[model samples]
Structures are given as C-alpha cells and as structure tokens.
Target: MRTAYSVETVRGAERELMGRLPEGALMQRAAAGLAVACGELLGRVYGSRVVLLVGSGDNGGDALYAGARLARRGAGVVAVLLSPERAHQGGLAALRAAGGRVSDDALRDIGRADLVVDGIVGIGGRGGLRPEAAQLARAAWESARVVAVDLPSGVDADSGEVHGDAVRADATVTFGAYKPGLLIDPARERAGALRLVDIGLTLPEDAEMEALQHADVADLLPRPVPESDKYRRGVVGVVAGSARYPGAAVLAVAGALRGGAGAVRYVGPAAEAVLAHFPETLVHPGPPDKAGRVQAWVIGPGIGEEADALEEVLAAEVPVLVDADGLRFLSPQRTRERTAETLLTPHAGEAAALLGRGREEVEAARLASVRELAAQYGATVLLKGSTTLVAEADGPVRVNPTGTSWLATAGSGDVLSGVTGSLLAAGLPARDAGSVGAYLHGLAARRAAGPAGAPILASEVAAHLDAAWRDVTD
Candidate 1:
C-alpha cells in the first residue's frame, strides 16, 4: 500500500526521528538519495551542469548538499540562492568545499543547466511560489528538466491545491512518505513522476491517505468456495432507470453481474430493456423494498422522476449505495439515521449541487470536497472525476490510481455504482468496496481503450471488468 501523511503528522514523526539520530544524520540520508536520483536522471553525472534553486529551508539544504555530491562526481553544479543569508550554512559550506559555486543570475544559470533542482519550498509551503521563485521555476521548465525536492513548490501538501504559481517538475524526490498533494490534482499534475526516498521514520498505521496497488485490491477481492450457493455468495438489488433511460438500468445490471456477486436483482420500470441486455438479472417492475432478498442495494442511476424508490431502498436495513438521481433525493438525516453503511457515488457536478457549491470549486478541491461530503452525509463518498477519490468520515481517504481519462463517458458512473454495491453485497467494508470498485472500473476502461488508445463506450467498460479482475488477482 502506498500511503501519505498529513504535514503535521509528518513533522511530528520527523522530530521524533531526528531526536534519536545524530545532529545531521537524517539530512545526509535524504541528500544521498537525492544525489543518486539526480545522477540517474542526468545519465552521465560528469560534465553535466546542474542548477539548485536554494531557499531558506531544509529543502534548500537537501538540494545544496546533493549538489555538493554531484560536484565531487565532476558535475558542474551551481546554487542559485533565493535567500542567500538564511540559506543552510552547513550545506552551502559543503558545496563550496566540493567546488560548487553560488550564482546571482537565476535565469541564465537555469536556462543552461542540464537538470534544475527545485528547493524553493517544502511541504509546509502555501499560496504557491513567491514571485522570484516562480520566475526561476518558469525559466527552468522552459529549458531544463526540473526535479522537485519533497513536493512541487506552491501546491498545498494537505489538500493538493495549487493556489498560484508552482514548480512543474519532470520528477519529484520525496522523503519519508508521500504527501496528499503529490497523489491528488491539480497539484498532482505539477509532480510528473514520484520517487520516495526512505529516511527511516516510523509513521502511524492510520495514514491520512492511501492508494491501493494490485495486491491490496486482490486481498480485498471476494472469492467463493465450492460449498457456496447463489444466496450464500450474496445478491445485490439495483433500483435504476425508467422508460426514458432504460440503458442505465442495463449498464448498471451488467456491472453488478460481473462484480463477484452470485446474483443481481434489479427493480425499475426498465425491466424489459435490462432483461433484453442482461437476462440473468432478476427484474422487478417497481418498489425496491418488495424486490426479494438482497445482501445490498444500489439505488439511483437515471431514476430521473422516480425519486420515490429512494425512500423504499433506504428502508432496507442492508448496506446501500446511492448514485445519480438517487443522490438528489438523499439527505444527511436519511443516511445519519441508518445503521448500515451507506456509500454515495457522485460526480463533480452532483457533489457540488449536494453541497450548494460550484462545480469548479468541487473539482479544484477534490480532497477537501470529498472529506466534507463524507462527513456531512455520514456515508462513504466516491467522488468521480479524472482522478477518483473515495473517502469516509474519520478514515484515510483512498485515491484510485488506475483511472484513465477515457472513463469519462456518460454512463461510466452507473457501472461504478453497481460494481461497488455488488462488492458491498459480497461483504467488503464500505471503504474497501468503494476503493476496489473504482480501481476495477478504471482498469476496465484502460483495457477497453486498449493499447491503441481508442475511445470506448460505457458498455465496453462493463464488458471488460472481468479482465480487469483477472489483471488484479493474477
């Protein structure tokens, strides 16, 4: 599992780790890894010109010290000090001893450099980069390949917001652990490639955020035994679509069938359309409450005017996943009163409407928005977009890594809702179901798009989900 910690938690751990080690031991460990990564990026460290954007923080020290190591290896290294007086004296001295010189002309030095190291701001930085730092950053990006130390300068470490000008690095060398901003957007776009350098700090078991890899998803994936029967494996009830948008019902049922659930019971006016596409589904005409026994229920995907079903679905004591039109009819009080887990799947526009905020606001502040929605609704929230975020109140937010831009189709969200609801039926926790479903949903889109990078329909994503499951479990 790839995990991230908050700025405060990381700072506390850093303090604890530093107290046990020698005065400069931790810095040396970080610098050594930084120098090695820079060397690899440059290919030939000898004769390559490297520029360090030195600031008044430990990030500046790391860059300067790494520059000294490169200088010793015959690389022509120059340090551009943004704050010459407050810069790390020990690091500066080491650079001088190893034949690295400080330059006053930031633009010229950055333009000619083979690699530019961004040390202007650390994780604690806010309000983007300073004017002078931003100028140097722009210059470096225009000419040389830049490597950011820790996080890309100017992005919020906790919320992943780039309020102003920030560094656009070719790669970022992070120490200790990853930050939320590195994994999230629009700050995530600033960090091109990420490399974690272990400086040996024991972080808490409960991380602020996590990205599930194949192994993690596989572990959470439900499997069946030989003794398992249809009802024993679990049945997921879906209340979706109407006469106008019967395709939504079919697509939702398609995803549920392949979601490791033994059975799918669909309740809606689109039974004929759903049965025509997916005959395996147990279809009901209306009123989801009377739709037989089910371990879990998925409500609202193109239910448009049929919001009455939302109440019937909520009355069931089983875990429920509400999406699309269902989210519109939902209230915090409705979920707060329920004892079973409730998962809310909403796209940026829907989430924005729920909070009475603008769509752009929700899109820009996805991490914060997801957290707030989860807290307010008292449900696990899957905020779908270019990058999918799954959050639960008082739990580490899970960022889905396998998402592709191709999954941004009209009915893709309905498929995700069904898949996650099926996982809930299979007895996965609300948080795990949301994370795994998003992972599988994204992976299926990638597979459907193929290596040709062609466009795919929502139906193709549903079709390729079994392949995605194999890819994960294999």
Candidate 2:
C-alpha cells in the first residue's frame, strides 16, 4: 500500500525528525535529494539553463540550495525571488557563492530555460495563488518542464482541491512522505509524475489516505480451495432491474459471476433477461428474502421506483450493499439500526441527492463529501467518479489508482455494486470489499479499453474481469 499522511501529521513527523538532526541538516538533506531528482530530469546538467521560482518558505530554501548544486555542476542557475525580502538568507548566499545569480527578469529568463523549479508555494499553501505568483507559475509551465518542490503550488495538500491558477509540474519531488493531495484530483491532475525522497520521518501507521498496488489487491482477493463447495465459497444475492431497465440485471449478474463467489442468486422483475444472459444464475421473482439463503445481498441497480424489495433486503441479517435506486430508500436510522455491515455505492449525483447538497458542491469537495456520507449513514461509502474513493466512518480512505475514461459508459456502477457485494459475501470486511472490488473493476475497464483506449460498453468491463484478476494475481 502506498500511503499518504495529512499536512498536520506530516508537519509533526518533520518536526520530530528535524529535532534529531543538526541545525541546517534537514534542509541540506532535502536539497540534496531535490538536486539529484532535478539533475536526472535535466539529463545533461552541465550547461543546462535552470530557473528557480523562489518563495519565502523552506520550499524556497530547498530550491535555492538545489540551484547551488546545479550551479556547481556547470549549470547556469538563476533564482527568481517571488519575495526578495523574505528569501532564505543562507540559501541566497549559498547560491551567490556558487556563481548562481538572482534575476529580476523572471519571465524573460523562464522562457529560455531548459528546466524551471517551482518553490512558489509548499504543501502548506491553501486557496488560489497570489497574483504575482500565479503569473510566474503560468510562465514556468508554458516556458519549460517544471519540477515542484514537495507539492504543486496552490493545490490543497489535505483534500486535493485546486483553486484557480496553480503550477503544473512535469514532475514533483516530494520530501519525507506522500501527501493526500498528490493521490487525489483535480489537484492530482496538476501533480504530474511523483517521486518521494525519504528524509527519515516516521509517520503514524494509520495514514489519512492510501492507494493499493497489485500486491495489496492480490492479498485481499479471495481464493477457493479444493475442499470448497458451492455454498462454502459464498453465495451473493442480487436484487435489481425493472421492465424499463432489464439490462441492468444482466450486467450486475455478469459482474457477480466473475467475482469469486460460488453462485449468483438473482431476485428481480428482469428474471427473463438475466436468465438469457447468465444461465448459471438462480433467478426468482418478487421479494429478496425468498430468493434463498445468501451470505450477502446487492440491492438496487435500475430497480426504478419499486422500493418494496429494498426494505426487505435491508432487514436481512446478512451484509448488504445498497446502490442505484436502492440508495434512495436509505436513511441514517435504517442503516444504523442494522447489525450487519452495509456498503453504499453512489455516484456524484446520487451522493448529492442523499446529502441534500448540489452536485457541484460534492464534486468540488469530493474527499469531504465521501467522509461526511460515511459518518452520517454509519456505513462504508464508495463515491464513484474519475478517481473512486472508498471511505468508512474513520481510518485511511482508499483511493483507486486503476481506471480509464472509457468507464464513463452506462451500467458500470451496477457492475461495481455486484462485484463489491460478492466480496462481502466471500467474507471480506466492508472497507476491503469496497477497495478490492474497485481495484479489480477499474483494472477490468482498462483491460476492456485495450491499448487503443477505444470506447467500450459496461458489459465489456464485466467481461474483462477474469483477465484483470489474472493480471493482479499472476
């Protein structure tokens, strides 16, 4: 797992580490790492024209010290002090001693530079950039490949929100540890490629956010033993579809069949459509409880307004995953009353409706919205979007790293709900079920999209799950 800490947590870790080192030692360590990363990006550091957009913080000092290293290696290094009066005195003196000059013609020099370093702001920065800083950020972005110190300027280090006018780096050299903003978007989009330089800071084990690698996903995936039987592996009950949306039942069942569950028992009005698509499914009409004993129930995907079955499924002692129209019937009291685990999967519009907030508000503060929903409902919540987030009431939120733009096609959410529900049936915890399910679902979309990245149907995403599972496990 690739974990990220909050700004406050990172500050605490940095302070602890700095206390153990000599007076300028921590900055020197950071400067040394930053210079190496910058040098590698520059390829031939000798004779390369480098410009540093120096701010007033320690971020500026890192750039200045790094600039000195570049200057010592025969690179023409120039520091454009955004705040001349407050720039690090020691760093400035070091640069001057190494034959690097402080230039006032920032824009003119930036345009001709081979590489530009962004130290305009650090991870501690919030809101939009100041006017002068914003101008320099734009100049650096348009003029050359920008390398950011710690994090891109003006991006929220905690929530991953980007205000107006921020620096766009070709690469970001983050010191000590990864921050939450670096893994999420629209701030994540601004942070190009990421490189972490360990400065010997010990953060808490329970980080604020995390992204799983293939190894993590592989560890979470359920595997059947030779002694396993149909009931032993797990049975997932799916309650979905209506006359107007029969295809949703088929898609959900398609995803469930490949989710490592022993069998799929589907209860809905679209029994004929589901049977036609997946003959292996145990199909039934009417209430979900009568559909037979199930370890977990997945309710609501194109169920329309008929919420009669939603209430019955929620009453079941088994773990339940509520999604699509099923989410409409959920109440905080109803969810909290249940003893079993409950997972709510909602896209932005559904989440907005549930929270009584505008879609724009939820989209703008995705991290906050998802966390709020999880606590309010007292259930695990997976907020679906370009960057899918799985947040429980507490603990680190898992950000899914694998996905493609092609997943925007219709019926993908239904597939995701079914996949997650199957994992719940297979005995994974709600958080693990949600995270691993999303990891596989997104990887399935990437497999379906192929190298061409052609547009694909939701069924294609479901069809590719086996390949995605192998890609992870193998």
Looking at model 2, the pairs that clash are none
Candidate 1, residue 128: how far the Cα is off, in Å = 1.4
TM-score, candidate number 2: 0.97
lDDT of 1 by residue, 1-474 (tens): 999999999999999999999999999999999999999999999999999999899999999999999999999999999999999999999999999999978788888999999999988988978898899999999999999999988889999988989999999999999999899988888998999999999899999999999999999999999999989999999998888898899889988999989999999888999888888989877677777999999999988978888887888899999999998888999999999999999999999999999999998899999999999999999999877899998989999999688887889998998999999999998999999999999999999998878888999999999999999999
lDDT string for model 2 (98-127, tens) is 999999798999998999999888888989
- Residue pair clashes in candidate 1: 128-154
Report the backbone clash tally of model 2: 0
Alpha-carbon runs more than 4 Å astray in model 1? none
What are the runs in model 2 whose C-alpha is more than 4 Å off? none
